[model samples]
Target: MAVIGSVAEFTAEEDWEEYCERLEQYFLANNIKDTETEKRRRAVFLSVTGGKTYELLKTLLAPQKPTENTYEELWQVLQNHLSPKPVVIAGWYWFWTVRQKAGQSVSQYLAELRRLAEKCQFGNFLNDALRDMFVIGLLDTAVQKKLLSETQLTLDKAYHVAMSHESAVQQVEEIQGASKQQVNKVKEHRDPQKEKGVISAEGHPMSQMIVSFEKSCVSRVVTRAM
Candidate 1:
């Protein structure tokens, strides 16, 4: 069996058949006996082939490359075997692209993704959307609450790291709010006359109102003069 020439290029139906045969042979040679592995392997193969076919169809549809009839034929071929994971694939592709820009290795990303998935209680498709922010962060929290709200997941645990972190954040916000309220209360309690520069009980026009009010003041002045 011949492997498809350059998976990045489109192959004829006969070539695709040969490619599948070759892939099966390779898998068998590796002693791939797990049924789940086989199923996922086939799914991945189809998804990749469908993507390649779609790319080729796009190329053929470009101006001056192929006629409308040829484009329609290729489009039909693409539409026939399109896989269900298109949205997942697109998100993963974008994630990888961004990871590349951020200089993060794919292995590290996958490890972090798996960690997040386990943390979020993702049983199915846990490994699939492990790295997706929407999947593991808030969405995971929401899902856990929906399914297990009446159980341990329902009640917030003080020991849970995520909940602890959230609690800390909330505490800081509450303290800040309380501090602001205190400041506002102080401002509200301040005398309006003092705020407007009019002296009250302390002294009116304090600078000029000085009288011989006390023997202590006279003694301090006498000592200073001496």
Candidate 2:
């Protein structure tokens, strides 16, 4: 079998929820069943740093060390230490306060909101809350209006509508930009007479004395100023 990717490394610098998500994705891609404790434990062992592994092993005591062999127990123990109830509550606070930032794309902002939602774990209200948060957090009033125009909007509904609307708007902007470029290119093929300020269509040597006239005007202005 081909290796899909390297194991997810979880160090102190990584966020708990993000690390868990990475691990989950890696597991899914590799067909590593989480229910298989031995395989999960082996994967976890390879993924974590030596120190983190040691810490996990030390969570159990005496003869009970062997009993803590399962990956579920290890995960639960890590959760207890790394992300207890207070930490999870703080995650929810941050989730509620998150707003789409300036210069952040719609897709990026949406992906971030979804990650924050995972951390918050809003239970049965998660779907509705996700929709409300997504709609409320958008920086673009036009997109928000388009999403809100729907009589009923769930998270999936809002995501699809917003994505489609944003895509359409982007497409129109791109077309207009391309059209403007073509127009400018056409305009750039200017009349040589205008560029040279000579040989006019009216069939004259088109004012060769223009620069002299301009200099005289400037001289007069300067003389008046002095």
- Stretches > 4 Å off in candidate 2: 1-10, 14-52, 55-77, 86-88, 194-226
Best by TM-score: 2
Q: Evaluate all candidate structures by whole-model CA lDDT and list the values in order.
A: 0.43, 0.66
TM-score of 1: 0.25
Judge candidate 2 at residue 14 and give its lDDT. Answer: 70
Backbone clash pairs for candidate 2 read none
Runs off by more than 4 Å, candidate 1 = 1-91, 95-160, 192-226
Q: What is the per-residue lDDT of model 1 for residues 1-226, given as tens digits with 9 covering 90 to 100? A: 5433333333654344445556556556555436656554544444445655545655645653323333235434444554222454455555434322143433444455554343344457553444243223332243334333334321123114333333444455565565456555555666786567654433433312332233345445434422
For 29-127, candidate 2 gives per-residue lDDT tens digits of 877765655765554554553566555657543345624556666666667767666567887888889999987777888888888887676889888
The numbered model that scores best in lDDT is 2
